[model samples]
Target: MTLSLYNTMTRTTSEFKPLVEGKVGIYLCGATVQGAPHIGHIRSGVNFDILRRWLTHLGYDVTFIRNVTDIDDKILHKAVHENIPWWEVAMKYEKAFAWAYETLNVQSPTYEPRATGHITQMVELMQTLIDNGSAYAPGNGDVYLDVRALKSYLTLSNQKLDDLQSTGDSEDSFKKDPRDFALWKAAKPGDPSWPTPWGAGRPGWHLECSAMAHAYLGAEFDIHGGGLDLIFPHHENEIAQSESAGWGFAKVWMHNAWVTTSGEKMSKSLGNSLLVSEIVKKVRPIELRWYLGSAHYRSMVEFSFEALEENSINFRRIEGFLIRASEILQRTPDISISEKFAAAMNDDLAVPTALADISDLVREGNSAITAGDNQSLGTIAAQVRGALYILGCDPFDSVFASGAGSNSSAMDGLVSLALAQREAARARKDFAAADAIRDQILELGIIIEDTPAGPRWTLAR
Candidate 1:
């Protein structure tokens, strides 16, 4: 099946035809660098990473761009609260976000541009808008995008210009129209400033992404992605300004659903305790990635410790089967993606259905193991690993070899010792003792199964 993605612009899932065939460019709005990353922030990263991986698997040359907002209002406020330079605050949290992404095994983008580094490009973009009369400076050094001058506006958000509210990005006194959004803010008394034709000021949040995306991906790109919360003012303003400047902007807009808690969008305030660093201590990074990427990209993930634990256990079951299969085959199984799995991934990135395919393979592979069918086990294990590789959670991948909860070799040895005790009880005709030993292992969430070869232990689902 050909790839079909849900385009937020068209409000339909249609076949994806890249502007340039076999070459795809994607711009994903990255971290704002105001604080450490939580599961909610990383969900966008993982979702887009899956899309990039699938595109690569299909032989598309993918150039992925994820930009960092290094200088923002929140970063400045954090700097003031921490009694440091705003740049220092941005660098600190930016490093924290980088570490979190690496820990989760998210692949590095082709280019990760910082908003502050591309001030020249932003100034140039603003100048184009100004020359086209799509923006104006109101003598206060603040440049505002003239929403009324745009030939097309609010197409992505599907909102009427008359119904739009004030952008609230700058002082209403500085804008000729209340609906006009700021392209550049006038320099403050003691804030970072860049020299532009209009004045010495910094770019707005929406302007940074538009400039960075245009700078790296040229006038237009294949896909633009971010969280659902960005669909309104952020993305809408981007379209209004970029198109007014004679650029096509993004061809397809993909917005992932939020990771919610108690039916509220997960924010740093509500997700402070759920930081990636804190969550990794409870579950392995690979397991966390599995849990985060399990749902469809457009589906909301309800945040809860109980749900996380259940998903981690399910991942371990797959991991255990792969480990046992490797031992039986005496070598790592080669990756072999199944047709059903590929089809599921192709259909709008339906990760849940793709995962179900992997689960089915694992189940059949376990049954093959119990029946001593090495050939079938090898084929099924290969397919399972292939499917997992696309999801960025392949057990054999070196990225997950030595992180938290990766002591699988030691776990196997300990389970083997317990199985030894159970075998001894059964050998001595002590059925009661054997049953008790099995019960103890089950309490630890490990299911011990006696087969023709020996006792196999897997994490209970």
Candidate 2:
């Protein structure tokens, strides 16, 4: 089936046709590098990673760009609060976000451009906007986009220019219209400054993305993506500035829904944010990724420890099934993704549907285990691994292999010692002692099942 995606610009789901027949270019708005990442921030990364993987799986040569805003006002503010250089502050959290992405198994983008490194591109684009009469310098070394002058100003956001509020990135007095936003902010005292034709200053938040996208993906690209929160002023401004400069910036726009807590958007100000590092301690990284990507990309995920633990336990069941199947087969099985899973993925990355298909495979695999049907079990195991591989949750995949099973060598030894004691008590006809030991292991969330091969242990559901 041909891939289809929901375009935020058109507000519809349609077939995806890349500008180049077999090549796809995607530009994703990446982190601002002001603070450590929370699950809210990483959700976008995981959702897009699935998109990239599916596209690649379909034989498309995908060039993905995820940019970093290293010179943002937030970064400078954080530097002040931490008593460090602004660049140091940016680097610190940039590393933190990188670690978080890696831990969650998010594939690295083909190119990750930093705002500071692309000053020349931003300057050139601003000059193009000025020459095209779509921007003004205002004699203060600051450049502002002429919001009222553009014939297609708010089309992406589906808003009327007259009804809009002030852009807020610059002083209203600096703009021809209060609604106009900053293309360049004039340098202030003790702030980082880069030389530009309009004197010394830094690029605005919106300009960094347009400049980098054009520099890397040319005048037009396949898809531009970010959180739904960016649908407003940020992405809208990108369209205004880039189109005014005579470039078809992005053919399609995609925005993933927010991760919310108590029906409120997750943010530091809300005091309900869960950092990736801390959350990983409570559950495995792969389980966290699965939970984050479980919902459709366009749906909100309500954050709750209860829900997260439930999903993680469900994932362990699937992982446990795959492990048992592997042991029965006595060798690694070949991967073969089912058509139903692919069709669901093709339909606008319908992850929940694809996951449901995975659950069905698990159920069938379990039944095969019950019937001792090794031939059928092997095929089902391969299909399960293939689906999990697409979702980045394959238990045996190198990224998650280290933490694949609960029964590691140390854990196995301890459980086995306890089981040995129970066996000894049973041999001596001490039924009470055997039952007590069994109860203790059960309290540790381990279940021991006796088979003709001997007693076997597994983590309790």
TM-score per candidate, chains pooled: 0.91, 0.94
lDDT of 2 by residue, 283-318 (tens): 989999989988898999999999999999889888
- Cα lDDT of model 1 by residue, 1-461, tens digit: 79999999999999999999899999999999998898999999999999999999999999999999999888988888999999999999999999999989899999999999999999989888888788998878899998888788889889898886655665487777888888999999888899887889898999999999999999988999999989998999888888888899999999999888888887766543479999999888998999999999899999898999999989988988888898789888889889999999999999899988999999999999889899999999999989889999888888887632345898989989989999999999999999999999999998888867778776764
* Prediction 1 global C-alpha lDDT: 0.90
In model 1, pairs of residues that clash are none
Runs in model 1 deviating more than 4 A are 166-170, 269-273, 403-450, 455-461
lDDT of 2 at 33: 96
Alpha-carbon lDDT, every model: 0.90, 0.90
- Highest TM-score: which candidate? 2
> What lDDT score goes with residue 144 in model 2?
96
